[model samples]
Target: MPRAGRPASPLITRRAAADAALSLIDSGGLDGLSLQAVARVLGVSAPSLYHHFRDKEELLTQVARCFLEEIGHQQERWSDDWETRTIELSLATRRVALRHPNAAPLALRFFPRKLMLPAYERSLVDCPYPPQFHAVILEAVEKFTYGSALFAAAAEAHHTPAMPPVDEAHFPYLASAIAAAPASDEDLHVEALRALLDGFRVRYGPRQR
Candidate 1:
């Protein structure tokens, strides 16, 4: 017997580490997430995770990258019209945020630019704004999408209503507006996207053919 070959160390791939971190986030939220926690999930020592992720921040960045990748997949089926695509992508982002409320904030802190550049380039192909203004338009859309998703996810996770109850006599107009608002978060997101796009169109006009 060849000296009972040293027991092989447990394998831990980058994808596996990221998956474990994401699961930890999903089950317990970010406060509970740690390299040690992820190692525990993978049944490996904390040092084992270091082979793939340098630190918890790196691991969390990978988690955010993976989350954005899900939305990227949805982009393949988006409408050809830029405005429509904007709404579709925004809603898709919102859906992912809602699904991973605990991990959603990572998007703000660590955007995976390399993973998203291709999709961003593609959006410009049919965009109605000039190349010079593409950044402005896209940035506005992206900011709104991220901000809206963050707010919506937090509210949903805490079981908070979009509009808390208000006294009708004290604020009749506001109360009436809230009463007439769309009943679902997605509906609200779409309405806001449309309004933002409409403003962009007005300011930029269509790109010169």
Candidate 2:
């Protein structure tokens, strides 16, 4: 008979369990990640997970921390311009989220505070944008990136939006803009970022542009 508590296998470590949980998220998203599911993936019992993590919340916290730590280390080389560095940081963050779409929601939901690394925070402080706009820009970038990641993930899963056929006469301008918009994900992201950054330039200065 198996033990009443703790993992059955000696090889199962905290890192291993976390990795397995992340794999589950990547494959089935946050809804698919549970202690039982992780245990199933690792060929162990659900109770075994309690050995490394006190509960589901603690497990998620660890998972988010791991991803945040990885993101922290994935920074680009420092640039002379703080604004340039800030944009580069946004792109880097978007790239990371795109690479882990399912995991993005978990990070967004449970650990919003941990999303922005310290170094990036410092760069934003030095940025020419006023203090009021700092929070706005950061939140906007994060929301956009997280939404984009979900869109990309859905696309990969062959989920497409069910938009009714546009009637030009009924909504001419809206239809025209939609028809003219760039279809590629990266293009849309860049366009949105430019528009947002342009607003900052108009209000504060052109340093971000």
Candidate 3:
């Protein structure tokens, strides 16, 4: 939608401010953004923002919560392989973060709000894994998802390339694995996760002996 008029009222005023803040962060990194910046973009007094938010942290919390809620909402009707739930959710999260790459880091973790946490809990409850295993599995998946995206995005956008390495002797399997799946971040994340679960099954899943 085009931005061409004043916000209709207090309700939209707050949402307008949030949308402006998102744009500011996307244009300039989060470090370059500020509440005053958002307020200016919204054509409102900086202090007026306080009418809707207690402080920058409060505003950021709202922004982060909104992103998480969007991610949760998008996955509300998923019907894919149950084992792939975490992977698909991680991908959905990446898609959300991609929309606000500058704020991607902030969207890296689940919002801690009661309303948001319950949604995550509900997803876990529906997963095939038991609670104890689900927690461990999801935690590991989220870490890889966020961490890979961070490094990958930075490397692609700003970092210089490093020389490729060559290894042979005792690292044959490691080399084969890398060759089998290329070094692209998402591919690496998926391959690593698959290897992890495969290893888990072999080592711990109802030992065949």
Alpha-carbon TM-score of each model against the true structure: 0.88, 0.72, 0.73
Q: Pick the candidate with the highest TM-score.
A: 1
Q: Model 3 segments beyond 4 Å from truth?
A: 1-8, 11-13, 73-76, 108-115, 156-180
Candidate 2, superposed: residue stretches over 4 Å from native: 1-10, 43-45, 73-80, 112-120, 130-133, 147-158, 161-170, 206-209
Report the poorest 10 consecutive residues by lDDT, candidate 2.
154-163
Per-residue error (Å), model 3, residue 83 = 1.5
Query: Candidate 1 on 114-161: residue-level lDDT in tens?
Result: 888888888888887778889998789889999999998888767797
User: In terms of TM-score, how similar is model 1 to the real structure?
Assistant: 0.88
In candidate 3, what are the lDDT values of residues 122-161, reduced to their tens digit? 6676565545676676667667777766655454434433
Q: Give residue 49's lDDT in candidate 1 (0 to 100).
A: 87
The lowest-lDDT stretch of 10 consecutive residues in candidate 3 is 155-164
Q: Give the clash count for each candidate.
A: 0, 0, 0
For residue 34, model 2's alpha carbon misses the true position, in angstroms, by 2.6
Q: Report the C-alpha displacement of residue 184, candidate 1, in angstroms.
A: 1.5
Q: TM-score of predicted model 2?
A: 0.72
- Residue 5 lDDT in candidate 3: 85
Candidate 2, residue 111: CA error in Å? 1.7
Better of 1 and 3 by TM-score: 1
